[model samples]
Target chain A: MTVELASIEGQRPDGQEREQDLSKSPLSIRGLTVTYGEKPAVFSVDMTVQPGQMTAIIGPNGAGKSTMLKAALGIVPPVSGRVQVFGRPLEEQRARIAYVPQRASVDWDFPTRVIDVVLMGLYRELGLLSRIRGEHKARAQECLERVGMADFAERQIGQLSGGQQQRVFLARALAQGADLYLLDEPFAGVDAATEKAIISVLKSLRAAGKTVVVVHHDLATVAEYFDNVFLINTRRVAEGPVAEAFTEATLQAAYGGRLATTQVSQLAHKA
Target chain B: MSGEEFVPLSLTPLLIGVFAAVACALPGNFLLLRRQALIGDAISHVVLPGIVVAFLISGAISAGPMMLGAAGAAVVAVVLIEAIRRLGRIEPGAAMGVVFTTMFAGGVLLLEQTDTSTVHLDVEHALYGNLESLIWLDAIGWSSLLDAEALSNLPVELPRMALTLVGVCLFIAVFWRALKISTFDEGFARTMGIRTNALGLGLVITAAVAAVAAFDAVGSIIVIAMFICPPAAARMMTNRLEAQIGWSVGFAVIAAVVGYVLAGYGPLWLGQQDAVSAAGMIATISGLILALAAVFGPCRSRAGAPAGV
Candidate 1:
């Protein structure tokens, strides 16, 4: 089916547009509670991510950071919640949102080239039985070049290194041409150079007025990399401007006693 | 006698086998790529009861009733497997095992309840097809194409299989993009608004139709080998989907031809009087080709390719 391409921020002077503009947020989640069988993964949480900013969902292991992201995207059904993107339901605004799942979630050895993966980003727009035109191919190539992966566009995905593979995934996300991007662990295992490249790309996205939410774990660079932080430990611990919300107390609360040892290691590395 | 004397005798049966093999291989590629190869085997076995039940209800073997029964059985097989997997929280392979074994056993019991001996529908024929006996006993040579009598005498299985293969190829051609995207990455395809679940169901139903068509000529057991072997061997030869499909059809046709020739004439060359079972020989040839591809394929890692990959 052809995705009905419409403005993420509705253009008509209607009551709906007025309500959406009042929120002024790209994503709004209310009472998002997710449970797995007898245990609750995420307690009742309310979060609103502003437009045109880099928001980091930071938490320690088993803190439900990724689970929260999935719940917001409607990938995993929340026990009870509502997620609105651009004041519309997530199902209605999915075309305007790009989602990059964890690198481990996909089969890298699939018999497809890098260009094919990038082209998949456009499949929603192309619809069924339609040939991907030269313009689409050129756009895909442009996206690949943006991530410094144009040279590897024709290569099989499995042939790439770990860092290069992540770049290809980024290129695929870029090809979506979405105003909002949700990425999961973009720097989990990359080298410093790859990490720098990814951060620069994320910054460029913000400069272009695109909302980018990343699930991050490295506490050392959170202050430097993010404009806003949502520290979560099953429930929302602290959230706001990174300088104000990302305090030592918040980190200690989210990570428990582990934060002391992490601070010592951070200091030792600096020395 | 000249070698040309044997051409007309073997031509129709050989063509039928080739058509059935090629038809199975087309949808078989997707089944292999999707790692549902056992489902292909499952559909083939389950359709046996479908065909028998159709005969029982209709009190005769006809195309419409038989196809309806087979297609219904195929859908039931898929649904049951899914239900068991979801309810029992078991491995998909185990679920498939439970559903298909019960359906096949049900078919055997159904056969026992009735007299299938009067009709062409017997357990032995369904298991091992009587391919050698399907000779076009008409007046003459290859030049008899001008006579209506020769054409009329041609076996019914040949044309039916030919049409089935054509329909399968057309379906694949129409849905090539959807099939590729869904088989490679289903979750992403769904997020793209591709209706991936419907596409996946369409594929399984198409596979069932192709299996049922092939079953009439090649029998049920060998359909499994035809469904998995050539596609698997083709996967070893190429990493591109289009090239893989082409290689699969080529391999399937070659197996049909080589296997038929071996079964029909190899005994004569060995100083024996009668021919061997063509279905068994074709299945054996498919296995050999798969083994060969595993040993010396372009992709060296294809020896034990994981289903998830």
Candidate 2:
């Protein structure tokens, strides 16, 4: 599997011109460091997400996986770093990107309907006056259909189950119609049906040539879910196709002694 | 109440109270749903110091300088609260508690030390504003409604409050979607280029302007009450933002009109001589409305939770 990964990576022409005049990685971060107080939260980490690929960033607890993602998007200010999307500054290219944050980051009990939550994705086009015509509602409804949440459009958000909430968030991301999708823990705490629904939607997104980067756990699903993987603790561990980068050595380095030997052995044997 | 008497004594103050209630309640809906209801409380408390400082600097009770001073104090309080929360690594609730309490106490001290006796400024007046005294001096009867001279002689608070309401309405109308989106999910709002931080500050500032304007006409008590009670009661009645806003405005109008009338006439009917404080009565009525909604509103309980919240 590892050899196959290396060969597939080698086969890429490496400059497909992508959506830009010059081919560039969809996301590129260099020497990024973020700090909360005295101690650094995420060190001088670097990562590159190639265009039109499903990539995963994996690490142990408190490994700053979420922080790194946040820094790339400027959600949390980085102490020292530079990030680019499609080879330009993030701010300039923000409209071309979509983000799905963790469910816990928001107040679920907020007064809104599911359709309204999805409609927020079109805020850029709607602008100040937002004389929302039927077309915007139709678009939101279509996004909800993509995530199998069409029937839940009129439902109050607070009444949703955890899995249903996750689907609604995915539907919102889909409504953005963006070229690049960055999701933080889209699968955490979701049920199996939701997991399958999310993956299928993500696969369709990739099939349509959109770039996807997810901060993922559940190592058992990594081989099946992602083609590209980046392992990190405070800094980059290894990054490449999952078959090549999802090695025992990289896992051990990322998780340290905190990872059990049997778990590592099972993952190795599973691969 | 005869039209001859009511037109002169009650019309202007009633309009001021209603305007004040609606203005504060409009933003209160968002703040309450965002779990930032206490921001209104904090802003109202800090406005006292702003008023006192305005008087000290300009040595006048004019509206413009007082409004500016109140706005300045509100900004300072917001900055101080954020500084304490970030620098001290303290939770927001505690930081807000510290800042607002200390600022309010300082305002009381300043009020005592300063010779504000010549003006209508005092701690008691600040808490329970002289809502009753804001009467139309030139109003004669129903004809006054159409008489430009009578209208010109209307209390200054009437127009000032109307303008404040218009400002609040315009802000909400222009930024409705952004405010709704950011209040729900700030991260997603940021990702969408919504300027969540600026919008958050803008929201607080809007609340501050409403608080300062309302505080001048009604008092801190009604400002605080209108900020929390109307929106909270409205929250109990619905799950939709539009519906919640509508209900809140309705509730505010009810509290203002009903509370003012009850304060003015209920005692008269009970064989009493003077009316009670309109500010305190409005606050009390709004609280009562909140209590009734809490117990009986259909959407009051947490979704899928047992019996009571």
Candidate 2, residue A204: how far the Cα is off, in Å: 0.5
lDDT of 1 at B2: 38
Scored on chain A only, each candidate's TM-score is 0.89, 0.92
The alpha-carbon RMSD over the true interface for every model, in angstroms, is 3.3, 1.4
Off by over 4 Å in 1: A1-23, A257-271, B1-9, B71-92, B133-155, B302-309
DockQ of 1: 0.31
Residue-wise C-alpha lDDT for candidate 2, range A2-63, written one tens digit per residue: 33443356532224433332246789999999998788889999898987899999999788
- Per-candidate TM-scores read 0.86, 0.93
**Each prediction's Cα lDDT score?**
0.82, 0.89
**Reference contact recovery of candidate 2:** 0.63
- In model 2, what lDDT does residue B289 have? 96
Candidate 1 residues A1-271, lDDT tens each?
Answer: 1112224433642465534443457899899999888788899988999889999998889889999988887666789988887767777777878877777777676667889888988877876678889999999999998888889888877777778878888898899998789989999887787788889999999999889999998877887888899989999998898877777667777887767866935522432
Interface RMSD of 2: 1.4
Local accuracy of candidate 1 as per-residue lDDT tens digits, B128-243: 67677666777367676677977887878777888888998988998888888778776566556667777888888778878887787778756888999999999888767778
Return the top candidate by lDDT: 2
Per model, state how many residue pairs clash: 0, 0
